[model samples]
Target: MNIIISNASSDPIYTQIMNQIRQSILSGELQAGDSLPSIRQLAKDLQVSVITTKRAYEELEKEQLIDSVVGKGCFVSGANKDFIREQRMKRLEEKLLEVIQDSKELSMSQQDVIEHLTILFEEDQTS
Candidate 1:
């Protein structure tokens, strides 16, 4: 559970925590059955309010990313990796749709945008 909170971001603290944990789980960094720190301990470690950590944990549970077992603390949920990957890709497509719309509004042709994306993709692949 390596989380670095960005206090300067517009996102709320709890949302920052939830998003990072979810990403970690989806990326296989936090595997199923991995134990998460207790809420109190995490709060102290992150130097955030207990309520903030609690809310983040609660949201993660709701998203089925983590499960709380009585007397055992919280553990990463047994979510299928394929499903998580699909879900993440779908979310990314939605965001890309918004960016595509903005690109059109800025008078950039689709081909231009795609060419730029291709360059970026190639760079990423090389790296």
Candidate 2:
């Protein structure tokens, strides 16, 4: 699996790892039963501490997104599209709520907030 971490991002390193792996699985880039790299290998490759990678993997395991077997590496868990969509929608809604809160706190008009979102959505469609 390929993952890109943004060190300067507001998110923590382990969260970045978790999000990227989850996205890959959601996008079908990583299928169920596909083994992930060893935590030590990934840590070395990503230039992050072993604790960070371990925490990320552990969180995924706790979420039932991946499983680990003794003597074997971690593998993606079998997940249905419905489950993925439901989870993704939940995450998106949470982020939308955060943005809405920010807009409200800033005293931005509803129309202006919607316009900004529209532009962002349009750019995403083009890209």
- Give candidate 1 regions above 4 Å deviation: 115-127
lDDT of 2 at 106: 97
Please give, for residues 53-111, the per-residue lDDT of candidate 1 as tens digits. 99999998977789999888999999777876777689899999998999989999999
Q: What TM-score, over all chains together, does every model reach?
A: 0.73, 0.78
Candidate 1's displacement at residue 31, Å, is 2.1
Write down the lDDT that model 1 would get. 0.91
lDDT of 1 at 62: 79
Worst 10 residues of 1 by lDDT: 79-88
In model 1, pairs of residues that clash are none
Candidate 2's residue-wise lDDT over 1-95, tens digit each?
Answer: 77888877899999999999988887889989999999999999999999999999999987778999889889999867688678768989999
